[model samples]
Structures are given as structure tokens and as C-alpha cells.
Target: MKQRFLITILVIAMFSGCKKFLNVDPLDSLSGNNFWKTRQDAETYTREVYRLFREGVAIRTGMILVGDLRCAPVAYGAYPPRGDFNLLSSNSIRTLVNTPRIQGDINTYWQVHGAWDVISDWTPIYKVVQAANVLYEKAPDVAEADQSMSAELIRKYQAEAVFMRCLSYFFMIRLFGDVPYYTNAYNDVPLPRTKDVEVAKACIAELEAHRNDLPWTYEDPANRAVRAMRGSAIALEMDLNMWLAGIDEANKKMYYEETDRLGDELTASNAYKLLPMENIAQVFAGRSEEGLFEVPQNVNYGDVLGNIRRTFTGAVLHYPYIQLNQNSTKSELTYTDGYLKKLYPEEANDLRKKYWFDNNIYNEDGTMQCFKFFNLALGENNTTASLSNYFIIFRYAGALLLQAEALANLEEGSQKAEALLNQVRTRAGADLYSAGTDKNLPDAIFYERSKELMGEGHYYYDLVRSRKIYNPDYCYRPISYGNFVQGAWLWPISEKALVNNPHMTLNNYWR
Candidate 1:
């Protein structure tokens, strides 16, 4: 991550306008043309692009929806007394919407408007993509003091950009279903929305083509550390392909083949390894062995403050540590011990239960609040200040599970699937694998995913995708008999987008 600092300094040097370039005014602002003259300039721009990519991946919306932390209550017209974590609440109503739920008006689902508007609005992403495209197109023409090194750097930058673009599109497709797939930034007019399967395939192809260009290991200045080699890319590719396979038949076959190949590559590379259950919290507590890709958040880096995890998971009684001041409601009902017990009743002895939550509070007489995210001592200013915790986007455990699921789906009664499932389950201190025909492979995977990745924003996707396979009726349900029909699966398209893009079509579930 510290290598990124070199790029940051480069951005400041080129864009800072301190240098008198080509007899230009000394104090005049530098344009993109004036900046891309040297290898250093391109390097800095590429770093900034990477920084943005990291930010996009760690967005709270993706985390909240995927992690299964928040759910809509019965009053809002969802089932299980709460909506699944993956499904965003409709924007048609405001009162029921809360943190970890869709913010602003409910109509935003159909219209494409909200705090998330900046992200879904599609400006910043294109900017990053455009910068990457420019670097790739101009790298050959630029004269560098070290020509070979400069060209190699340019290639690396281009690969990173392509990886980021594919990643951005993957998230967009998951959230919006159909989105305009932009290959080149210059083609500005919004392209027609492609089917989700098509988009996933394109994303996979781009990752595969550019995988070799990216460096497997990056040197860290802080501890002279090295992390995220080629294995990381292969693991990510496997994950993306597995997701694509679950969506459709053609994609299923393509993704399965890719996953198998990548899985073998990952196993052969031996660069990444899973963390022990005892070490999982510490792994998350700081930087540990498990994170495949993560967004580094340093308190010194001004933009990286705030207890987003604590704020989302903590109850009001927990107060300041949880950022309770941000919300109006302060009821204890929100934190249901019974609900949690029900979720993990069978594994009470598991150490993860203790690591996953803190049953104590700081206030003189306060009840226990969720302290899974509290890291007071790691911040810069206050002991209770937000710590610089990197959000883990992908982990080796996820890879293991993905491999298991792929095997189960492809080959009937494969022992590999059960063995893989047990590996993760045993680590979590759950029941051992038995030699029996379990028809609920998806459910087993979902349960393991829920336990292993709680509060990480994967629950919603698991729930919705599982519904598509196991129970279709539960996939779409009426929000209320007359008020609105919040389907069993599929989030409503933001209404704000609909208002802006006439060509945008609402999902059948929403209409």
C-alpha cells in the first residue's frame, strides 16, 4: 500500500503547478496535456486511479447489502419479520428506511437518485476508466529516460485499470441487473443495457486477457512487506466466474471452466492461504494473512475516518462508539438477542461468536452492544476514534467455498464439495461433514457463508441467489397487499434513473 504513496507524490508534482514547463506561466494550472509528458506523471495518475478503485470497492452500500447486517422490519412489509440483507428496501417509503438500508426517498430505486446517486450516476467510474485508457493509448509514444521500464510500468497501469473497470461493472450489474457496458470512455453516449450474463462474461474476458500484465507482489515501504501476487488475481477471477455461473446457463458453463482452471492455478501458486478461526478477528482487526483485496484506511489519510461498521451494527445504547447520534431512533428492540441466538444456536461454543460480537459496553450501566467492529486504540486522535481497518473484499475462505460450490454444481455427488464445505465449517467450529446426500447444497453454502462472512455484505446476495435456485415464490413477495409488491428477489431499479434515462426499463418484479 505504501508504494501507492510514490504515485500520490507524482500526482502532486505534476498537477501542483509549481514547475515552469515549456516556458508556460509559472503559477498557471497544469492541464492533462502538460502533465502526461513524463513517466512519473503517468505513474501518479495511475496511482490515483487505483485509489479511486479501492474506494469504489469499499463503498458501504456494497458492504451493507452483501454482509447481511441490516434488514427491513415487518412495518415496512417484508418477511421473516425482516427483509433479507441483500435486498435493498424500496425507496417509495422514507420512515422505515434506516442506515444499512437505502437512504433518501424510496422512489430512488426506480428513478436512480439518492446519496448513492454519485456512484450509480456513473461519472467518477468513467473518469477512472478514461484515465486508464489514455495511459494505455499514449504509453508507446511517450519518451522515457528508461524506455523499457517505462513501457512495463504503463502496461502494469493498464492492467490495473482493466481489472478495476471489470470490478466496477461487476458490482453495478449485481445492483442494477442491466447496465450500459462501456469499453472506451470516448464513446460517451450511454450504451444500451446488456443482459447481466453478457456483462459478467465481458468482465471475465477482460480480467483473463490482462491477468499476466499485473505484478503478483508489491513491495511495502512500512515493513518491506509483499502481498497480493498473481494468486490474488486468480482468486478474484475464480470468484467473479463463480458468481457469473450462478446467474445463467451459458455463463454457468463458461464460469465453471474458468473457475476450475483458476482454482488449479491458485492451488499451484501457493501464495495465499486461509487464516485459522482463532486468528480471523485479528486478521480483520488489522492487516493479516486472509485479505486477498482490501481498501486501506489510515486515520492520517483524512478521508479514512468514521466507524461505518460499528455505526451500522451497534445499537443506540452503545452510543458514541456506534455513532448513535446520526440516527433518531434509540430503541433496544433493534438489537434482538433472541434473533442472534436463533441464528447461531447450534454453535454457541464457537470462538467466532465471541470474536464476532462484544457483549460489553463502556457506559456506566449500558447493555452489551455489538463490538465486533470497535477498534478504539488504532486511530490517530482519540482512543475511541475510528481505527484504520482495511475492508476485506475477498478472502481465501471465500475462494475455498467458491471452489466447493463450483464442484458441486458441475459433478454429481462429488466428495470434493463436502470436503471443502467441512474445511470451512470445522474452522468455524461447526458440525463435521458426513457422508450423506445433502440436497441442500446451496443452503449449506449459504449457511456457511452467513456464519463465515457475517456483517461483510454477502448475505443479501446469497439470499437472493439461493432463492432463485431453491425457492422461487420466496424470491418475490408483496410488500403489502395493496401498498407495493416487493418481490421475493431482485431489488427495485432506482426510480431516479428511470426519470433520467427513458430507455431504462423497470424489472418485471417492480412493475
Candidate 2:
């Protein structure tokens, strides 16, 4: 039999129905005098919301299809199995290796199912929002009751919750054009969708409100790399403002100004810097100084998370009979004709391309597999524990590049932007661009961002946001420009997300 649990079986309600969204209501048996009586209660709820970052690899809630995998750089096709012809010929084995890979394949097999749902499933993401709401709302009561709860501790908890909600909404607005904004858990009735622009502004405002409460690092040193910081909030603010500037021309100057301000704030923090080129791989491994924010991954708690680098973006498994002369590893993605040649020219002498990618790593066809995500944590005791690589959500380089983009777009900021761009390029051992090098500063920034932020899940969003998705001259594969212009880039809402919600409406294109 299952344990009944001490206070409530569920920390945050699993939402059995609209009425059961939270386990304890103000008037319920688990509420008021019973709960919010200790700092531990608030901390527990905050921890539950943290699980969202941990769930990055779950097929239902992961970033794979939504952000990176569906982007232009990837060519989804065949991946050879880890055996001789005699072993691979069996029906069961062939089905095992080919079916799952083929189903998700966007090009060759072309049998993508509920494709949008892979990323657009709003249920779990909303649950995170719900948990944050519950914790944030209870912060005041928890402070009043627990004498041991310092003002700073209470503020940190509340700020963490706010960060969670802000990030969740940012993800929602970026992926879906409009989404219902929920602030409290008690409102179970369906809410109407809010404009993405309005939601973005609200997210920025929230981060600004709570940014001061978070420290550069958590008290637990293990959490230093994993936890959110003031830098994280500042980075998100810059990104959202710039996203607004890119998509909406009417407010371009205003958004760009804010983007510039936020970027400047992050740079002035003096808390982060780009990693040394020789140690670029260390950037993705947990808590490097280069990271603004990352999700900690280790052997015990990291297994459930599917690492895109080692699992999805790796090369096909190689064996004696395959004749491909490859190693036995599985990678769901690879580069196509135009990706490498366009951004990273042969003579560019880019250090990152050589450091982070290889032509001969289990791929003998002269194709490439990303080396950026190879796990340094698993150097010796390694198995299939690919999740050991700390998921690098935000880092110093992204912060620097985003700021450079904002500067490039402004009228007088072009020269400063060029210097900023060259800072990153020079560090990477690439040639610096002279003045008037690019057609315009913005395009130059986009090109720079594409090269600098590859495989970090920022490229697709950059293209769509910059309106570059409409330009056929961009990357060659993945979603077509024609379909993207038709609003196909925004995902269709899941049918289940619409159940029993009268006010809910699907994206018009999908409907």
C-alpha cells in the first residue's frame, strides 16, 4: 500500500480537475493553520517547480522539437544501427532502431505525428506556472509564521518563483503567438489568450521587480551553476525586449532601447565572462564561470533527462558490417550542404568549429556531429548517462552576443556593436570584420549570433524573430519559408489542452 504522506500526498496538486488544481485551499483541511506554518513548506513548493528544468528531456515537455531539432541546420534522416548486417536484418531490431528515429524524422521518413505537441503540450508547462503561483502567493504567510525565516530568505524564495513564471511565460509566448496568462491557481475557468507582445512586456516587468532579490549564486555551492541569478533575469529581459523589437516594427526603437539597457546592465555586472577557447567544452559542464544560468546534472538525478547532444544530435552507430567505417554511437541530427559553408567558411579559421565539431567522429561520410556537448563529467565512469552534462540554459557568450545585436540595430550604436561582435569573433580565432563589412549591422549581428549560438537552442528562434525565416536565402532545410510565412511556424494547440475550457481558442492557423 502507498504511504498516505505527512501533510498532503501531493506537494502541489496534480490537477485532477479544475477544482483540484491545488491540494489545499485557504478553507481546506491542509490550508491556513496547517500549511504555510514553516519555511520548509515554501521551500518544498519552490523545489517542485524546479523540476521543470529537470524535465527538459521528457518527450512531452522537452526543448528538442520546439527549439533546436526542428531548426534549419538539422537534416533528419537515417542513422545506421550498432551491429553487423546479420544482426540488423532481424525485424525486431530494425524496428527498434529505425521506427522511433524515423517517426521523429522531418525529412526522409516524413512521418511526424502530433509534431507540435512534442513542444506545444501546455499542460505540464502550466503545471509549473501553477506551482510557482502557489509558492509565490504563500510567501507572505510563510514569512509571518516562521520566526526563523529571514527577510532575505523569503525574498529569495519569492524571486525564484517569479523567475520560474517569467521563464515559463517567455517560452510560451516565443513558441505560441498568444497564450492565456495565469497568475493564481484558484481561477480554474478557461482564460482567453493574451497577445505575445503584452505577455513579453509583463515577463520583463516581473523580472525587473524581482531581480534584486536573487544572489549571484545560491548558498549551496552545488547550486551555484544551476540556480537562477540576477544575471539570468537581466539576460531574459534583454532577449524578450529584442524579440519584441525584431517582430514588431512599430515599437522597434522602444524595444531596442530597453534591449540595450538590459544588455548593458548584464555586461556591467562583471560577474561573467566568455570561457577560454581551449576550455569551451567546459562551458556546458555544470557551473563554469561562463554560465549565467544552467541546470545541474549529475549521475543520480540526470538519467531521466535525454541529452540532445549525445542522444539526438550524435552520429549513427557504426559496426563492421555497416561499411560506413563509423563508430557505434547514435545521433538523431546532422548538418547538410549549406550550414557549414555559409557561416563558417573554410578560410575563416574559426577555432570553435574545430574545437566543437568534427568530421570524423563516428561520421565517415564527411558529415559533422557536434562535439560541444560531449560529456566531460563522464570521462571515466561513463555509461549512457549523457545527462551528466549540465544543461547550459544561459551563458556569458549568449549574453554578450544578444547585447551586440541590440547595439547593431541602433543608429549610433553600429560601431560599438562591431567592436562587440569582433570581441567574440577574435576570441574564437576568426577574422575580425572591418567597418562596412556587412550590408547592415543587424544582418551582421544575426549572422554572428547564428555562428556563435549554434546548437544552444537559440538559432531557430533567432531566425523567426528576426523575420529571417521569410528570407529563402537563409539555411536550406527544415521548415520551408513559404510554410513559415503561412504561420505554420507557430505550433498547433494540443486537442487535450482545449478540453473543458470554453474560453480557450486554438491558434487560428492550426484551427
Candidate 3:
């Protein structure tokens, strides 16, 4: 595991000791000594952390794997029975989607991929967290040191950093359950796991306290909708609120209320909205109008590509890799007939059925691939025309669905919930559910979200947070939904994570 940064205090002390005792001007003062003394310094350090967050194994790839593949909600049939097994391997030629070995139990996770380099490398996330923590602690002092820097500007910088830490922790808990909480950059000792509920409470409080510091949109030159802003923080709060509702029974009401408030505030602003149904598929191409925060991946840097595209692209299309290549084992891309029907029911005519998934599901040749993030290689340019698809972290549709779920749970805003659900459904060219006819409005809201956010990586978490993935009989199960709720759907903390910090233990259920 690589350390993201040395302790800021230790570095300053070490450098200060190196200065001349006679007050002679030094020829080699470290640049880091002046780092937190200016606004530019704060901004520059932020870019590094954001870059690290993008490349981190857990963030870059784990989101799609846990949110979509691990407990797949659809039976994506494939030729040669492409395996949907979850492991952390770079062997993309025989990917988990293409060749699922089907080891679903905690005891058997090691048998699938012993090293577990990809998904299990949770350390990378800690790097980003540490960076944010350092920034959060130093920004205020930096502003105080510089006479020209305003306290307001410093607070905004601090708020964004806090949002980053909170965002990373939110996903950490979502993926690994309990995680060791850190605030300073130098906490290298092994720490015990903190209860997720407490962590969530702390994070949400921090976000709410500083929400006013950020703006609704950040289109500044250095960050044009690329970084965390007010809307991004609000969206995160909505997700955390919903997840807390499922985990913390004592505070369930509070969670719902905050969820409703944040959703309402974000919706009322009208800063972002769902695009027309026709452009839904193209939403993943990068800075679309509806995006709250999307991580850009430039093709020139040779990004790892999106898991949605890599896992869902069928062997038929010669995208990314040529059709002739032997690495053509893409089974986890197609959905079973029953799952397709459930996704877009008979009465509902979701345009997403065509825009997101392959329209011709009946084609036996197995050409039905998800078109959202497909990296089409123009045969003439030899990969020159192919571009990286942006990872959509937060969007308007997701925010609206979160609000609709909260309203449904309250059972007081049936009309508002229906309107919220309809905003997404109506855009998708889907038939709207009448408030009078829908008895289980809560389930309907959750289901509509499942369809709208299917391949974009929200379904599995949605099921777990709403306590819907616990039952084997749950209707959302794909054909290979094994060990669905034996462990609350949280992955075991890697052996490496434990070794790095021996005080930490495996997730409660896995232990």
C-alpha cells in the first residue's frame, strides 16, 4: 500500500530544523513550506487528490463491480456461459462477465481470486481520504496566513474537501461496512473499525454544516462541472440518508426527513433536470447538461474504460478490442427474458429499454449489448477516434428517485411522489403509474428507479439500502443471485486491509 502523503506537521518540522540558526537566508527552502500560504496552493493540492480519487482501484472500478456485478439483478446470458464471478483481476480477456466461476460464498471468495488486487485494494481510497483530510485541516490556516485570501473563500475550499472526505467514507461504508475513520494525514497506526451508523451520522452532520459554503454549480476554469459542488454534496446526503434509514432503526424517521429536505431543496433549485428520453443513452459520454459531478477520462491517457461498457459490450461488436480477438467472452451483458420483462413491464414502455440495453433482446446470435458506454472503434482511425466515456457519479434522475423514495416511505406526499417518479418515467417514454391504481407506491418508486438507473450502477445498492435484497424470494434477483443476504451484501475487508491494520477485522457477517 502506497502512502498518499507524509505528515504535514512532520514535513514542516523537518524542514524548519534544516534552516540556518544565525538567521542567514536559506538557499533551499522547501516549496511545501509555502504550500498552505496561498489560494493557488490549496487549489493545486485539490487537483492531485481528485486525480488520485479517479485512479483509485476501489473508486475507479469497485463502484460498478459491487453496485452491478457482485449480486447481479439480472441473468445476463452469454455464449460459453460467460462467468459473472466477482474477483479483482486484470485478466480482461476472460473477465468475470465473460467467464464467471460462480463462487458466491464468503468462504470461497479467496478461491476465486486469491491476490484480489483490484477490488480488495482499499488502500487507494484511503489515499484520497487522507489527501482530503489534510486539505480540510490546512485550508483555514492557509487563509489566515495570507492577508489577501478571504475567510469565505477559504471556507469554500474547506467545504469541498470535507465533501470529498464524506463522499469517500460514504462509499467506503457502503462497500466494506465498517471502516477505520481518519482525520489527519499521519494516522498510520492500525485502528479499530467504527460502526457505520456513527460514521454516517458524523459525515452527514459535517456535510449539512458546510453545505452553504459550496455553490449550486462550479463551472470555474479549473473545474467545469468536474469537481464536487453544492448539488453534489446534496445528492450524497440524499444517498446517505436513505442508507441510514435502512441500517439505523432508531433514527429512521430522521433519515427520511433529511432525505426529503435535501431532495426538495435540490429539486426546487431546478439547476439540473433529466434530459429528454432520446438523449438518455448519450448521458455517459461526459459533461452532459444533467450531470452534477462526472469524472472525466481522457482517451489520450488510455483510461481503463468504464465497467458498464467493458462488462456489457457483447463479443459481437469489435469495439475496444477487435472481433477476431480470442478475448471474446462477454456473457454478463445480456439479460434473461424474465428479467427484461420485469425491468420494462408490459404496461410500461420505458425508452431506456432501447436506449440502455440492446433493443433486439431476442436475437439469438448474442449481439444485444448496452449502448450507453460503448467505445466504438472507427475501423479507419485505428483507435484514434475512440474516446473515454465519463463516469456519471451523480445525475438529476438519481437525485429525483432518492426524493421519491423518501416521500413514498413517509406516505404523506403521494401526489409529490408520483410527480417525482413521473419526471423520470415520462422522460423515458414509459407509461406513468396513476396514484389511484398503485397501492404499493413505495415499491413502485423503488422499481422505477431500478429501471432508470439500471446499468449506470445504482440497483444493487438501492436494493441493499432499502432492505430489499435480503430475501432469496426478492423479485429483483437475477438468475445467479447467490448468497444474497447472508452478509448484508457487504464485501469482506481484504486480508491485505487487515494485515495493513491488524486491529481491523472482517465485516461482522463474514467473520
Each candidate's TM vs. the true structure? 0.72, 0.83, 0.80
Task: Compare the candidates by TM-score and give the number of the best one.
Answer: 2
Per-residue alpha-carbon lDDT of candidate 3 for residues 139-172, written as tens digits (9 for 90 to 100): 7766666776688877888888888888888878
Ranking by TM-score: 2, 3, 1
Computed on alpha carbons, the lDDT of every model, listed in order, comes to: 0.51, 0.63, 0.63
Choose 1 or 2, whichever is better by TM-score: 2
lDDT of 2 by residue, 242-323 (tens): 8888667798888878877887777787877887788876777667778877765555744423332233323322222112
TM-score of 1: 0.72
Summarize candidate 1's per-residue lDDT along 211-308 as a digit string, tens digits: 78876545552211112335556766876777676667555766676676777676666655667766665555544555566556555755333434
Clash tally, candidates in order: 34, 3, 5
Off by over 4 Å in 3: 1-34, 57-60, 73-81, 86-117, 144-148, 305-332, 362-365, 375-387, 473-488, 500-502, 508-511
| Worst 10 contiguous positions by lDDT, candidate 2 | 83-92
Worst window of 10 by summed lDDT in candidate 1: 72-81
